[model samples]
Target: MDFGFGPEDEELRGRARAWLTEHLAGPYADIRGLGGPGSEHEAVAPRRAWERELGRGGWIGQGWEAEGYGNRRLSLTGQVVWAEEYAALRAPARVGHIGENLLAPTLIAYGSPEQRDRFLPAIARGEELWCQGYSEPGAGSDLAGVRTAAVREPRGGAAGLLRVTGQKIWTSLAREADWCFVLARTEAGSRRHRGLSFLLVRMDQPGRVEVRPIRQMSGTSEFNEVFFDGAVAEEVVGGEGNGWTVAMGLLALERGVSTLVQQIGFAAELERVLASYAASHTAPGAEDAVLRDRLVQQWAQLRTMRWNALRTLGASPDPGAPSVAKLLWGGWHRRLGELAVAVRGAAASAGPADWAPGTPYENGLDEAQRLFLFTRADTIYGGSDEIQRNIIAERVLGLPKESR
Candidate 1:
């Protein structure tokens, strides 16, 4: 299959590259590499401003087919080109991705026209940031087990506010988000995936909504615990009692151009690791044959991943494609983290000599240390290896369901 970009796509790529070069200046220059995966805690205020800048450039919601959302409708390849250029420039990690990528797509697909009008323009303008409120204390990968509940008040008829009361854990960017799309149960006696509703709730409810940062091993608190106590949810996408379908649709959209963008970032990381290995000639184990082979294998595997991603992009809806992509990159990243530390030998184990006990986590360690620590959760987040395999088995392979 020919995955190369056509003439029009090449033009799009050039335009994207030029736009990034022109805009990433003055106030946005220093923020080039800030707010990525492990470094989300860096430059919080500046990164939010950067999101607005991207919106101004019409760079946020490029894939949507709709008109007049402050976004330029682009082909899938055009979206991929923009993503590649954006990653190559090391632009500040997007604070509005959940809204632009996940929630906006979901709303376009399943939301009422009113819902889209109310939310999509703000997302496109980068005026409102969003966080996902799907995972909870007990329902990380097993999304069907979400227990958050939303109840409607009797006085306001069908348009009455749904009062949400529950907790969500591991919510990325919750601290900076202006809104959250919550998956909550609306029926009194429903279980598992039944009677669920996808609710859009505002994050600034003062006493009703609370966000507490969860400090990770990397010493950054990008993820947070969100409490919605009688929080107001005025809109439900795909109607009430149909959240499971809407949520699954949103997950399916995850395997789009974003995956290619991720591969570009991974390639850059691999280049840095290779550069480190080249400089570590005198470091112990750096000369080891096994370590050398692992580095080569990492490069080869990353290439294979890119090809696989390109080959499958825009293909028919394969139930296992998303899970397969998750498994591939998740394990590959964890191993790369291990290799990043391994190539550095003994020096990788120690923090800076002047580091004090009370210092902040970001100041205490270097990039490799942070990468190693943060990638520890790579396989666990999004979806665990076990869950991915089970999805492939049951959904794609026609295997029997696991004994529950």
Candidate 2:
């Protein structure tokens, strides 16, 4: 397949870059590269505002059609162009990506007309932000092992309100999100992937819902522990007892254009690591041939990943693709983090000491330090490497299943 962007794609990229340059001013100017994977906790309010700014510029839903939601229905190549430009411009990390990328597409595919009408507009406007409530206390990678229960209830004129009760861990942006789409067990006596339903729950309920921030080694609390005690879910996306199907579909959507955007950010991080290595005077290990070779290999693997993602952008769902992507990027990022700290030589171990008394700044690590710490969990969260390998072996390779 031809990988080159045509003239139209170039024009779209130019427009996106120009818009970002124009609008990334005032209070938003300082937050250019502020928010990202390990740094989501930085500049929260400003980043949320940036999401709304993106919506105002019609940059939120680049792949959706203009007919129903008034979105610009760009080609897959155009979407890549926009994503690449967005990353290159060092725009603030998107707070609305869960809603725009995962939930919105799934809704468009499986949601009722009313569901789409109710949700898509607010998402398109970036007026509401959403977080995912998939992983439970027991179920981080094995989503089929979800145990959060949602009991149906009737509230006033509403016919099918759900009282969801359970705990979800590793929920990104749970504290700041206005809503959450949760995967929970809806049927009694159900096991594994059965009896589950995808419920859209509001987070503003005072006593019903609780969100406890999960502070990371990176000195951020972007991930959270969300508790639901009789929490109310207004709508179910793909109907009750079909949450496995719906959840799987949403996971599939996760591997789309955003993967490329992520790679661009990864490239930026890699650039920083290279710059650090160039500037550091710490011994000669920074100039080690093995480390230098690994750096080149990282660059080559990243380029391969970008091409693979582009080639598979519009292809039909392959269960292996997502898992492979996860494995590749997870390991690559974790390695990059390791290389980042190692490049600093002896100084990587300790942070700047706090000389003043009565102050709470002791372990204040810099960006590279944080990246090294945070990426330690890269292969564990979302889906572990072991779990991903199992998926590829069993589902893709048609191998025998491993005993539980």
Candidate 3:
């Protein structure tokens, strides 16, 4: 576990730092990798342009084969470096990222030749967008209980003409998405987990979909609820009847590397908080000291999450490890938010410092408050904190599974 970089990596980091310093400027607080302007708009042109910049420069795709898609044979260390630098830069999460995070790996693992050829290049190019559709009314934490039926059309014109019909909730960033990777109940009459199937729907089609936003406590439509009608055929990533595995794989990725960015970014934010607190020179008070201690504890938790991700990504593919990271960050985020609110005092509930006009400190404080409230769902999504503990108990700690 040598954190030290080699000669080449040092050179790469230097180059990346220079490029970021030159390119990123102004008050663009939320700019992720190659995505869209916002979740409300279909930023096809803007996203594609950014993707082209990354693709042509060989800066986007990592750990993928060359020519077939984007970049080639990106080292694990390289991936870590990219995440670290990007987090350090404080870039917002990327757009068109659902595909980049979940489907890309599935494509590499089990997608058809045509599927790979058709989707990979554009995904790498960010010409298109993707969203996940796994959670259902009956299956949020218990994803294996998904009931979204994707029956094959009798007179199928396409290879997999699945007539998807069910409801999915908490579909973040889905309102303007062009495509979605939906997990449905393909094996009808079959038991849970065994009957599930993953289907890719072209959301651009009419009479097939409906996406509505779930206004969060933060008053933003970051989370959404999507409905699917039995209509056009859909594509399958990996293979049919393999949706259970594919969905789980995607969940692991979602809660793991895709989420690794948040942990590191939180750590960076903690550092910023530390610097800010030190420079403020507030009067000594018991409440202030308690709040300060809480933030310090939060800093420790963020470090734990980073190390956990590093070990998981670099070592054994423990199915439960991502759950641990999710749980840690969820709780850590809430704790820090509470502390941030405490520091902001009356204004904490307004906004982040210098982020917006008026009392942005209060805004940031409010933002943290909203985040802390949402953290309640952290363990539940991508499986639950209870489930994560079960995993670690049985798998990592070698405890016997419960005889239910």
Candidate 4:
């Protein structure tokens, strides 16, 4: 398949690059590489400000084709070009991605007209941020086993309200999110994927919703534990008791243009590691032939992953494509982290002696050290390696299901 861009795509790439360069200054200058995975705790106010900046540029929902949401409809290739440029410039990690890339598309596909009007404009304006409340303490990978319940209030003016009650673990941006898209069991005694509903709940319900940050080994709280105690959900996407379909569709959408954007970031990280290796003459194994070979292999594999992502872009639905993409990038990033620490050798273990309480992890350690510690959970967080393999085996290869 031809991976080369057309003239129009090239023009888009140039425009995107210029826009990012021109606007990523002043207050947004320091946040260029902030708010990414594990380092999400950095520059919160500025990153939120940067989201509005992106909104003003009409760069928030480039892929959405909806009319009058303040979003410019771009072709898939154009979206890819924008993403590539964004990552290339190391722009602030998007605070609106969950809404833009996931919920917006899902809304366009399955959401009600009222739902779109109510939420999409705020998302497009970067005024509202969203968190996914799908993963529970017990249903992280086995999402079908979620026990969160959303009972509809049957009395008076509260009749349309769904009282969501349960806990969601590993919810990214939970604290910053203005809303959460929750998957709950709306039917009593429902088993597995049955009786599920995709409900949107506001996060500002004072006494009903609580968000507690979960500090990781890397000393960051990007992930949070969100508790909903009779939280009210007024909107249900794709109808009630159809969350299993909507949730699965959203998961599939995860493997779209964002995969290429992620690869661009991965490539940037790899380049940084290579630069570290080149300069670390005193570090042990920096001169090792094996280490050198591994670096070369990392470059080659990253190129291969990019090709695979481009080839699969906008292709027919494949059951295993998202899983495959997840497995590839997840393992690649974890390995890159290991390589980063390995290249630094003894220096990687030593951090600042005066590390204070409540300080960001990056303050005490170098990028390599932080990268190594943070990537440890890469394969685990976004569906484990084991889960990806099972998806491929059962869905794509037609293998027998693993005995539960």
lDDT of each: 0.89, 0.86, 0.67, 0.89
Name the better of 2 and 4 by TM-score. Answer: 4
Q: Give the per-residue lDDT of model 1 (tens digit) for 255-287.
A: 777888888889889899988888877667648
lDDT of 3 by residue, 114-228 (tens): 8888888877776677888888877787777888888877776546467888899988678657788888888779777897777888887777798887765444456788888
Model 4, 52-88: lDDT tens per residue? 8888889888877688899988887787788888888
Name the regions of candidate 3 deviating beyond 4 angstroms.
Answer: 25-52, 65-67, 157-160, 279-281, 284-287, 349-367, 395-404
Q: Model 2 TM-score? A: 0.95
| Candidate 2 global lDDT | 0.86
Model 2: per-residue Cα lDDT over 29-97, one tens digit each = 999988777777888898998888877887777776435684677888888888888888888888999
State how far residue 373 of model 2 sits from its true place (Å): 0.5
Candidate 1: where are CA atoms >4 Å away? 282-286
Query: What's the lDDT of the predicted structure labeled candidate 3?
Result: 0.67
Better of 2 and 3 by lDDT: 2
- Model 2 regions lying over 4 Å from their true place: 154-160, 281-286, 355-363
The total number of steric clashes, by the backbone 3 Å criterion, in model 4 comes to: 0
Structure candidate 1, residue pairs in collision: none
Flag the better candidate by lDDT, 1 or 2: 1
**Least lDDT summed over 10 consecutive residues: which range in candidate 4?**
152-161
